[model samples]
Target: MTAYLPMDREERREMLASVGVDLDHLFDSIQESQKLKKTDFSGLQQEGISELEVVERLTALADLNKRTDDYDSYLGAGFYDHYQPAAVNHLISRTEFLTAYTPYQAEISQGTLQAIFEWQSYISRLSGMDVSNASLYDGASAAAEAALMACREKRLYKVFVSAGMHPEYIETIETYCHAAGVEVEVGALNEAGKTAEFPTEKGYAAYMVQSPNFYGVVEDLPLLVEKAHATGALAGASCDLISLALLQRPGDLGVDIVTGEAQALGIPMSFGGPGVGYMAVTQKLLRKMPGRIAGETVDRDGKTSYVLTIQAREQHIRRERATSNICTAQALMATSATIWLALMGSSGIRDVAEQSAAKALYLQEKLLATGLFENTYDSPVFREFALTAKGSLDLYKLNQDLLAEKIFGGLVVDDNRWLLAVTEKKSKQAMDKFVETVVRLAQAQ
Candidate 1:
């Protein structure tokens, strides 16, 4: 607040005069509609507030938010509501793992580097790629970095993306492309919610698609990869990590690069993010990959050790020649994911995948059986699906009513379409209650 500024009255007047204005007109250049007023500060302008007052105010504000513990949520577009194992926190929270976020010093940070190496190994195996980076910021930023990598590798300024991909991802890619003077052409999706066959054009560096796309429709990865190769372009995909337990790995399908959200693995949604983004690439694209990479080698004693192997970001390499600007990895979230994958193994991931898909299918069936909703797309899904309300429904108001009962509902994709997600966390009773709430709201409306 201005009241607590260290500047005295004379200093303030002089500073105001230097800008050719008095105190009352200091913000005169600002538009009247957007100018800040003293009244906006509420209670901390003229009189200084104590630490206790600040705490009380912040506490009151915090009470206005809806906590996940109090709400049964079904909203997973990218970030999921999957249950995190208790051991994940207990392990990642250890002092050695918790504080060693960035592994710049290889000698002192072997433990951190090794953790990241394990994370990369898990990502590579899960994605079926030959190599993987330490990690990235989140799914959206990782997708952007993938596009950049493709364009740089092929020396082409244009790339093709699927319209079926998440809109947020598309926007992020566009931002990265715009800054780099690259062009992004969005391919169309068929009526069944799958990305259409690639175009016959030849000068693109890569083609990107999201499997189990925004509509939760699985795209034809092999077909798309073949088409991309036919056009002399690399194939890239954004996917869900857990879905790979049951689906074909992208590397086996000829995809050159795989990037996706790993939030479902162990990280909580935390009201949308800070999510862990995993990126894997074939052996050919290892150098082109952005972010850090941890590698294993023997020390002087001939014991196993980990070190920072590759860092191709602006901070490490020549700025103009650097692959990306991102330097540090999301250490805490990545550690959680690595621990979760280690504990889950193959069978645990498969079970989570199966149960999530089963629960999602059951939820969809219940909604459609109510006669108030219909299928939006004719496609198979992993853990999320969409439905079209058959009647006029105020989805916003409907969610409010659900919240009143400590329930958080589906995402409104558009006007009448609802995107519903289910994870291993959702039980039959919870989904039944969601269906009942929707019916009750529809009838009330």
Candidate 2:
């Protein structure tokens, strides 16, 4: 048994008093019907245990999980399993970088500000845009924020989003639109899994699409952007950062805003997050972009310095006048991304992208040759693709079987449709094993 320090009634009262609130006052806003009559501790141990015992208990619980390292995973909808360089962790784990907060006092925080400046520079180059913010929450929220920025810039109440965009990103955009009194119209996807058409309305604020979209099909961005321009709406793209190394930059393709999840740039999936969201905009929408922007300047000593240039968020400006309500940037995650990019450089990133694309193509061809799966779309893909199970094959059961063989299969997007992802980390041997297992399972079915 371990000695425990429980807060007595007197201690609780004292703490509450110090905060200038009573227990009832704290719960005043909560609905009576929703209030819990008693706390439920059903799953917890009733008695306290020693520190060592607590660690052992937690370890036992953790061991119950099917960790990715133990299995060959093909799961990448938005988050990917890219190779994270050892330097990313080593540099990010430094006490100065780990504990640093928002660089509000740039005079004393040059290192943090410089890291952010470098991150912004990298994103600007990656997206081929005029300006990039320090960072946002994640890819979904970044897309939503871009929609808000477009609405504000175009001064319109309606926005058009492609059906090919990630479902979660669409949902997030809808949530932001609902709060901002804006309307979202979802465009249709053609047989090739590209946005087929855009609303021919003149009042639309923006038309958004994702390259290597949810179906893993790259859209004809130039055509889509042309159509959006015809309707006087700015075109926005939520792209995969890694694909940008091989694909043409959205900015060069005339996209007004480019946003994406930067997780592939050395950040671990960690069961889906703490990923950095990067946003870049053309010169026209630069001032309207959300989050923080780091700008280079000269100090009193005539040396170079980096400082927060534009903060259009609610925390920095008057509430009603603010461009957005975003309060802070993902400084640590952004630093990791910056370091990753610095380490990989341009050629290394291109190599990773090319390898991923090649592996995906190889896997797709092998699976299709097995006659067990059919292609969901006939478009070119960067790293991921969708396949439909042939005949009466059950995708759920197939995935379970794959798991049994220590191979985590693709993510099931719809009925009998699996969205499979391939990364540079997946070797040819692993690919062959996955294909063989799928072929055997199809035969069994």
Candidate 3:
């Protein structure tokens, strides 16, 4: 058998000797009281199994998971259930793209750099912004980072976020702001499902709102932006990228920073993870944007090339001076989103957005027809909406009943209100079955 460490006894001895101590001698300085004679990993150590046996065990464990493919799912809060094109996986899985790391050296990393550049361009065009960073961790972090950027750019310590934003995103912003010594204030949502009140004082750095927010209601962004501007604060929004296809661009509404989860683009809802977060800003805020930005240039040989430009991450510069402390970009995931956008083009994306909206409306109509559920808010919505079950039919019980029918129901947002989402991937027959199941559950109650 090959030695895992790649060192023979003699070589190991020589290395330890050069370090001026043997393994035991190296640990001689440790206090006897703090040292352990034997490592006790109780209950965690398992008996060794053969390779085939291990595979079988893992397969058995994996089979316990309720996969989306086998069940009807309406679960979309941030992560979605869009159909990823086969070509997206095929192209992204290529060795050159999949295994590529940060493209620090432009000469040897042209392919990766170009891919990132394209990703940035796609996001910029979709967002109607002057520029976009390579990518961030996820929607929550991107929103948090955007708040920080706003604070830095406007030179203010206070930020105002709408109560309509995703709860998780709000919590994340609070954590990031607390650490940065910035103040975060959440404004209330009005009857029209829009952020209503704003501080009359002119000390806020930015006003952040989410359209098709956690409740899936489209906020009045134009009016919101105007209010922010009146207070001399930048308007930032955490948006749903797919919804942007059918709605007015935040940039066109006078927003300074647009950040959103790109999961609905082409990425899967792989158990709520590995989704790319995109951040785009007006030209003036480009330098303060977080993460890597790829730029097109000419090589010494006069050939077009791509390179990392405007990297404001802490690793590349002084920590205090860095615009953001995000260590890396979501290169692979961003590439997936880029490929999805390229494949879909503008028309395809619009078609998807339209289909999702139509389906959601259809579901809403179907549920309301049965008199089992009613709309919680009367506002323009895109692919998702909130509904309240009539009578004593609890959302948790309904979800459990749905599980029995091999269907996953909408997420429970409030006490009897459920947030349901519809994607283009859901078929008419499937939606009908889901509606039938809900109707039956309602009747049972």
- Against the true structure, what is each candidate's TM-score? 0.88, 0.92, 0.92
User: How well is each residue in 128-240 modelled by candidate 2, as lDDT tens digits?
Assistant: 99999999999999999999999899889889999998899999999999989999999889888888877876999999999989878988889878989999999999998
**Clash number for candidate 2:** 0
Model 3 residue runs over 4 Å out of place are 1-47, 312-317
Better of 2 and 3 by lDDT: 2
Decreasing TM-score order of the candidates: 2, 3, 1
Checking candidate 3 for backbone clashes, the offending pairs are none
Stretches > 4 Å off in candidate 2: 1-47, 312-317
Model 1 Cα RMSD, 1 decimal: 5.7
lDDT (CA) for every model shown? Answer: 0.87, 0.89, 0.88
Q: Model 1: runs farther than 4 Å from truth?
A: 1-57, 312-317
Tens digit of per-residue lDDT, candidate 1, span 242-330 = 99999999988899999988888878777788888889999999888988889999999999989877553345556666677788788
For every model shown, the clashing-pair count is 0, 0, 0
Give me the displacement of residue 374 in model 2, in angstroms. Answer: 1.6
